[model samples]
Target: MFSEPEEPTATRMRRARATACAALKVEDAAQNPIWGYAGRTLSGLVHGSEEDGWLRVVSETAARAGGRLWEGPRTASFALPASVPRPALHRIHDWTEEGWSYRAELYAYAPASVVSPGPVLDTDLDLSEAWWAGLGTALDALAAVPTDRVSMREEYIRRAVAEFTGHAVGGIPWSTAHGDLHWANLTGPELLILDWEGWGRAPYGFDAALLHIYALRAPETANHVRKTLAHFLDDPAVRVAELTVCAQVLQAADRTPFYAALADPVRRYLKRMGRGAV
Candidate 1:
């Protein structure tokens, strides 16, 4: 029995990318790019003019939520300095000039994220102990950026509490957080945090709590995160943050397979901590 020849993966990717680009109406979009795709939209990271900076084409809804999404698929650029370790929204472009209605927005790209060794849930990252110190420094730097982005609010916490634990959430210490601090959003080797759209004030330990929960599949890594960021996780407000993130994870398990392994442990954690036992 003879088998049909297979299409080269590169060729397949190129074809798919071409289709996506054509759909987005970005004729200038790079062929091979780092894609942040969700549902029907595509956020492709591509190079830009040295003076203008990089470009990122994202879904219209997502772009509107962060930048100027209501401005009719327009482009908005940030004046952020290059020294910052964030891919802050630089500029956004609407497809209206091209008379296209694909419901996508283009953005000026930020500094590329570091090449990760592996997924955060795969295993303990082989980072140096000194790198942990640097991680603290980087987090501190991120915290210093004054932003109004509110990743989680009291109502969100209350809903999660009522739906999952049925316990009232207490006072939470608020601080600037990188709302989505997962392995995929984080870049390593050089330790750069990606995706700043979620940067904003949140419960004190919210970021660390989320990170620890994601690391649960690998207990050793989870333990390491707890130990390293103990100052944040050890706070009294951590109870609220932990429940909040766990509830959020449980909710997410229904939608994405990424949080499948986390669903059970998160429930157990909520039961333990939700009763104010922790």
Candidate 2:
């Protein structure tokens, strides 16, 4: 004979309550449900399914990191300013169990945008020229301000140059930067840029160089990026050199996994940067 044990519905509800009670400071724990579509990340994407509406659970690790980065309450206390268009943080909570404790945040989920499935390099959108001009404008504005007045640190500048100087010929002009700008991080129409974790001022061409090097996979496209940049920046050879260095540094850091996934031409650019081949 065989026997199995099953909890009654009331017992199951109690268990669920205990779990929620341990995790959150509940003003109320009503069954408020929500749904989420799958979103992509550097690691991979979690797909949405019909069986369960997407649960926006913030784990302890994420709560801790957010607290460290934002220097505030871990959960349910505050929200980022509305001026920012990235994902919204709904609430934060702490969960405790035997010998373990963790923090987490609940987030309002937005449907994933319908993104083009082509390689970043081959996208025919070809705003290389516009992007180039925008970058130049941004750089010129940044450079007009004295470095001492800006928040940029000398060490950061040096590291930027050192990271890419091998491939580029000379120094680029210094300026403030968005730090990270890529197609994936951008939203259409609104041009809302997210993930401000690393935002700061840096050299003038740093963002453009990063985008060109990482997104333009084909040599022809890369050449186009270079031409656009040169034209927009008025063919400033010194600036180009500096930008190349910055690009190399970005490629090396490989923060976005897309850069790591690139094939030979991309790798070659990085290698050239290391050797100052440009």
Give me the candidate number with maximum lDDT.
1
lDDT (Cα) of model 1: 0.57
* TM-scores for the candidates: 0.70, 0.44
Model 2 misplaced stretches (Cα beyond 4 Å): 1-122, 126-172, 218-257, 260-278
The worst-scoring run of ten residues by lDDT in candidate 2 lies at 35-44
* Candidate 1 local Cα displacement, residue 177, angstroms: 0.9
What is candidate 2's TM-score against the reference?
Answer: 0.44
* Model 1: per-residue Cα lDDT over 1-278, one tens digit each: 01222444334334444544455444544444554433223345543344333344333332233442233223112422243345445344344222223233444454545434232385666666765666566665555556565667778888876686666765666776767777776655555565555566777777788888888777887888888888878778677777778777777788766666678877777656637423
- lDDT values for all models: 0.57, 0.41
Give stretches of model 1 more than 4 Å off. Answer: 1-34, 40-54, 61-84, 87-91, 97-120, 271-274
